[model samples]
Target: MTANTLVNSKLVCVALNDKAQLAALEGTFNEAPYKKPPTQPVLYYKPRNTWSVDGAEVEWAKDFDGNDVAEMVVGASLGVVIGKETCRVSAADALDYVGGYTVVADYSLPEQSYYRPDIKGKCLDTSAPVGPEIVAADKVATPDSLSVAIKVNGEQKSAFDLANMERSIAELISTISRIMTLQPGEIIAVGFAGDRVAVAKGDKVEASIEGVGTLTNTLGGA
Candidate 1:
């Protein structure tokens, strides 16, 4: 499916699934009253209000001081589209249910605290930008090691390698399927590593995955 059809799908993102991100939050998760690392992936809702498409120009949140051209956090990640209704699938068989992979740029405000749900920071209108196209599973040779680079205004801000993911993409799919059934067209945004890139208003943000294609968005005002 294309980016325009992503609006018909549901999205919730997985966090701390990357080595860098998990390491960043390790101390906090270890220090909490619970005093232990989580066995399951940390998840957050990216409700319908947050969905957008490639090249979409979205409004700035009130947190941006009503300016669209301000620095916002952008995490470029790989999204796995569920091919069929899946529940309790094994990692070995998970790929059988994958539709394909697509580039996902999940935007949010800065200063997100991992201690609680970041609804205000994450679930804003057009915060989740999906696009380019879905590259078939068999088409991508190295799904585990895809490199994603983020450039703002044609300048590279950060480039993250998917090789550092704590869980293999298939493993995440299998684990998630055990808890709840995922329908066709549903998306699971695999995690991203490194700090979220900061992009200002009018910045041209491009998240490119060589063979997979690029998902580009420019921050603009209402």
Candidate 2:
């Protein structure tokens, strides 16, 4: 259940669920200085090397020259696997294309804000931990209405209602599809909120969504 990809490559795609992508897109659109919503959908692809299996230990690499040292976020995002090729589909038809949902931890060592480039910090090996189980899309009727939170060592660190998302899941899917066809099993990770804290070795991380359940992993020093 582990996947790997090369560094700084565009061909590798992390499997993020639709809801995750939509939440991130909304955050980006709302937080932009211009205050204008995106006319088109935005999508970010993580390299394959980012994938880490459930319960696998995450290594913190030493601060190398040219690499900024900072605490990375243990982001827990809901991931949706596409079941069909969907292009400009309607909201009513959106769930039909979704194969299922899973829990994913999108580890983020942000080198800069969303406005700046962050390929190295985000694409590092074992940066993405995904799994537990794939819940069918039908199992959760209202994907956009779920609650999400993150906990470190049983302490609540982050929490939010999906309703807080500025853009609706349907809108994001429809918008993204217009730009590119969505294939079965491809993932779309929703973004995280606030400044991410630094995690050291032996830290237990948990990401929980109301309907999708929690994904847990431990951190390790390199």
Candidate 3:
């Protein structure tokens, strides 16, 4: 299904390990050094425009530099699909709200700042590719300790264990629910632990999660 058909409100993509990401961000916040990391979940909503199904083609539109500039970064992350309307949920009951899990490849252009949301940089067409299949949350043996990785053209560029998340999936869901009500079919892309790599046209990107399976997509030049 298309993103609009699957989601009604927003798709929250958590930015875990706030300190590492902040160190990479391009600018200052409030004209001061942006040193303090968010104590709570750092969430960014990727609208339907950014969603694409697994195996779909994601367009890497040429930039002001023309065809030579077709490139975007891919963030391979575990995703939680909400099973019901969730609001003010508790960490203890957070997983109960999850319907299933899916692999998500969050695509975006290189940006230097988090002080402001970069709509165009992140919400481009086919930016968030999710699927392969949704594994029921209960069936995911250990969602908190799965292995995650990203590959480009069949070569692994980055690999990491979810064991390192600053906040577990349950805690993230609980914190996020307090910020906004999540509806059925909407998703929360659990944060990535390491660096995201840039991919260009003609490249095939794959996001693999140990239990959830891999989501693959090809990059096409616009």
Candidate 4:
């Protein structure tokens, strides 16, 4: 397993799970193609090809959307690792299926509209740097109240608290399980909120979650 992930695991990320982010995209969602905001968990994926290890030199992302993405976002997140097969579970018992937690830096070309995801922009190799280490679930008593921060070149760029999440960890796991069964080793990136700072090539990026762990990476290569 790469970067402590279990074999055949997938990285699932939630979006618009915070009030600020939802408000930021409200107008767009209420317009044309979409007449309303999503009621259920808005999920996305970072498949195995995009997985990067802690301290790895990540390649810059591409603009598959044709915007020629001038910058990308270093999304500081807390990753929930699944311990067993979970489907149609209850929020009260969701933690029982969680194996542990890890730090994840989700890199992506900024989304102009959330309607359709830009494949190459979202799934580029070395885009999702996961795990410095996994702290057992029991160790993280309050997964939804942790603080996550992002630093570029040692300067604080962005920071947000998991308390801002519209859905708690238990809710996300329980709600998401109803649609897809999460397998052992797969991770649920609870998502980030507010605004994200734009990053450029050669920047030293660090995403940290106090007691959990820190993941650092450098944006480089083609």
Per-residue alpha-carbon lDDT of candidate 4 for residues 1-222, written as tens digits (9 for 90 to 100): 245433246889887787788887788888878789899888889888888788888777655574445778778789999999999999999999999999878788776667786675578777888888888989988888898999999999888889888889999999999999999888999978657668888899999999898898998843
Question: Which residue pairs in model 1 clash with each other?
Answer: 69-201, 70-201
Better of 2 and 4 by TM-score: 4
lDDT string, candidate 1, 1-222, tens digits: 224546345885888777877777777778865478788888877888788888887546665466443457788888888888989999999989988888888888874567778887887788788877888878986788898888887888878788888888889889989878899888888887558887676678898887877888877652
For candidate 1, the TM-score is 0.90
Which is better, 2 or 3, measured by lDDT? 3
Better of 1 and 3 by lDDT: 1
Could you give candidate 2's per-residue lDDT for residues 1-222 as a string of tens digits?
A: 154411112222222233444455565657666265444433566667677666777766546684435566665656766767878898767777877777667676743544544676677777777666677888988887776688888899877565655556666666666767887767665444433555766789887887787777888763
Clashing pairs in 3: 26-112
Pairs with backbone N, CA or C atoms under 3 Å apart (clashes), candidate 4: none
Best by TM-score: 4
- Stretches of candidate 4 off by over 4 Å are 1-8, 63-69
Order the candidate numbers by TM-score, best to worst.
Answer: 4, 1, 3, 2
Tell me each candidate's TM-score: 0.90, 0.78, 0.87, 0.92
The predicted structure with the larger TM-score, 1 or 4, is 4
Instruction: Report every candidate's CA lDDT.
Output: 0.79, 0.63, 0.78, 0.83
